[model samples]
Target: MDTCTSFKGYGRVDELEEAAFKRKTRNQKIILSISLVLFLVLIIGVVAGTLVHRKNNNNADEVPAAAINSAEAVKSVCSVTLYPDSCLTSLSASNTTDPEKIFQFSLLVVMNSLEMVSSTFPKKFINRADDPEVKEALKVCETVLHDAVDSLDDCISSIDGNQISISKITDLRTWLSTVITDQETCFDALEEVNAALVTEVRHLMKNSTEFASNSLAIVSKFLKTVEENNIPIHRRLLEAKHGSPSWLTAAHRRILQVGKPKPNVTVANDGSGDVRTINEAVGRIQNKSERIFVIYVKAGEYVENVVLSKYQWNVMIYGDGKAATVISGRRSNGTGYATFVTATFVAMGRGFMARDISFKNDAGPQNNQAVAFRSGSDKSIFYRCSFEAFQDTLYAHSNRQFYRECDVTGTVDFIFGNSASVFQDCKILPRQPLPNQFVTITAQGKTDPNQNTGISIQRCEMSPLDNLTASTFLGRPWKNFSTTVILQTNIGGFLNPLGWLQWQASDPPSTISYGEYANAGPGSNTSRRVQWAGYKPSLTAAEASKFNVESFIQGTSWLNGTNVAFDST
Candidate 1:
């Protein structure tokens, strides 16, 4: 009986051991499956990281070239045409009335303007190139640009004035640097798209290439035009051979240069380099001087009120640069003066000349009306002068005047009157809180147009202190026969599309003559201009003949000096 019981226990122990082994095998299999999944996940993560890094690197590589190219293209197109070259006519041509220099300088400015339009092509194209077609088109743009560059080189080599002054060379070098940067920017942007471009992109590229081509052609044609129109070098040489303006004979035998100071007069206020105060000087001078009476003012500021009688004929005031000499007053409508017509400098004399000085009214915008300078005098001339105020800056009461290289700034009717006036190479700066109503240039001559009364702005620049909004007008007729013309001037983009505004709807058709001719700049768009019944859209050659310097003001009498030859053209 004891042997049979021991055999049963041994069998039970073996069965338990087999069960344990089977359970261990199942657990091992489950562990192996989890380990396999973890390995796969790590491999996937590494692949994804590598792909992201490569894509970022590619994007970075394309960025600089694209940015550079785009910028260069835009800058080259929109650059100024009439800056440094035109500057030659401003200071260096001080007493030089040579027509050739003036014309050449003017034409050079036009050529320089071609750069402004060229810069926008690349950017416009890039912005439009989101389609597959644009991308395809752009793929071959670099080749075309390279060809264009080659053509430019040929043109440069063909030009005779290839060797310019150091300053000119420096300007060209700066321009080249900018061009290179723009070109690289464009290239980089194109590279960023790589081969994954869409149809829209291809189309945009095509358009851009075409635009670039067209712009380059325009530049080429402009260069040829410049070469052809340049008054021949031989003509300049011949002009030099002729005696200078100093040796030219005058039509009249009158003394051109004013004589030195009188021994009787003693200088009191040396601050203004004057022998006497403006009031004292005017008080002393008699109206009967047969020769021209000139007061040569050295560089200083004169703050006083002045008035000249009608008998003070052939009077002249000359100074240093406008910034160096100033004639200022704070008189306004309700302030110091009893009347709004009270001006800082008032002249009723004929043949009055003022050069290189500032006449300012410092009564802030709060003053409704302030007269900076008033000219009741006929045949008045202002050269390199400035008229500054918030309102009613210049009042050319009832005569004729000429302003050359003058700066006129104000908010309302700054340059207004019944006089015939011509402003050449002047700067018209408008003030803030005003856009369409900034310029009220004329109250007009109630007398007659045949009597020679109008306002002409030639080769001037218009600027606004406020932000540009497309709704400004040139002038409004304050009275019937209000006439104003902007000829060969640069109008600012702040101008509204409509060129004129009616003071009121009741202001009828036969009242004014507002004319613009051959004007350029973003503001001079004729397509959207107002078609008012009174405004003359074009000036005929015969009608325009009335607006020359000699006729506008009787400048022939007083513009000559030892070193200065006044330009009548």
Candidate 2:
């Protein structure tokens, strides 16, 4: 009985020990939960504080603010440089009066460089951008730059000022720099988010030097103009420089000097230091300069084609004489349609002047179409020149031009164009190949009534080259309202009794204005000529003055050195 009681007591002791152990474990678990919760709360507070501090610091970084400020400053500078009429007035108030031209000359350099950058670098960069927004923004910036340049061009063309200061030009330079800088900043803001943006930004930076160099060159030219204007004799001398005894040949030689002439530039046929092929000499000239380049050619047959780029200006090509020196091209209709009309000499450069040079497309009658000279230049002049061809010859494409003392020969409508041109003292030769092959002088003109484009032949001579004779007309209207005039000219017997040809049976007579003023020759019998509604044989002196060289060629500024007589009668 005693042993059984001891066993019960032990069991009770074991149960109480197990219960105490369980209680200790519960207390430990509760303490662990409370400590873990407190640690988590502290971690959350620290993380939130860090985030807020970073946000504040980012906002305080005022580089973005400064960029905006700089942009505004740039805008202000541009307004001062271009917007204020007072600046133009102040510059013109001085004794010198060619600020507008000087500014234009300087700005052309900047524009040309910018064009190169925009065409080359910007295209590559835009295609490589990954972010849509960033790419669009860059495109927008480029567009803005282009638009700004165009606006600047317009402003320069219209601005009437003389002698702009270097400081004022510097302001423009700053504005252009700011435009590039701002674009760079935009790229930077996007770069971290968009890794691809680096290419565009890098391109901008790389090309910025070229842009800056162009700007610097422009500023330098402006300064030079101002300094030149300050010198009284220098300005007058430049304005009043007279033509030399061999002015016609000298002018062309000067034009060829614009390019880097070959080291061994040999005039193959002459003792009078002059080039043979103008193109060979043109290789030596620099782009975008105001200096006049003259190329002289001695009497010889130069079988080559020549092209004058738009960048080349104040260029002149002269020969020993039209009869002696011939620039000839043999490409004809057999040489593809393009080659058929390929000119022996193409004058595309603005302010291009040539004299005493016989430009010939020597492609014979069997060759079909051949162009001797093609000119699409504004303010262009061809004095004492000759254009010889069998088919299509003179391709006067666009702009206002003057050809005085020239001999032009062709079978078809040789002088074809959509430009305002006046041919004075020019010999018009019509070569007849077949009996019915009618000689048409002009084919195209201003289709729009608003456009001022037409051909005015003043004091010209019309003659036949071959024994074969056919009815020749003044011109056939290629486009609507084809305007042509034959004023005080000697019309050859080869001219058809009818003055003009009707391309189609029912041409808009109102559209074309084919007229003649006191034309004298065997073919100038007005009584037997075409009784077309548009033909007017008699004209007053005031009416004929419109076709004069001075008015048509804008010769007041460019003809300063020339002594050519104007066809006033």
On TM-score, the leading prediction is 2
Please write out the lDDT profile of model 1 over residues 41-92, one tens digit for every residue: 3333444554456567855554344333333322322222213222332223
**In candidate 2, how many clashes are counted?**
24
Tell me the tens digit of each residue's lDDT in model 2 across 458-562.
767888866637667878876667778787788877778777887778754666777778788898887776666766666565555444443333211122222
Model 2 alpha-carbon drift over 4 Å, by segment = 1-266, 269-276, 339-341, 555-569
- CA lDDT of each candidate? 0.51, 0.55
Question: What is model 2's C-alpha RMSD?
Answer: 34.8
In each prediction, how many residue pairs overlap at the backbone (N, C-alpha, C within less than 3 A)? 53, 24
The TM-score of candidate 1 is 0.50
The lowest-lDDT stretch of 10 consecutive residues in candidate 1 is 1-10
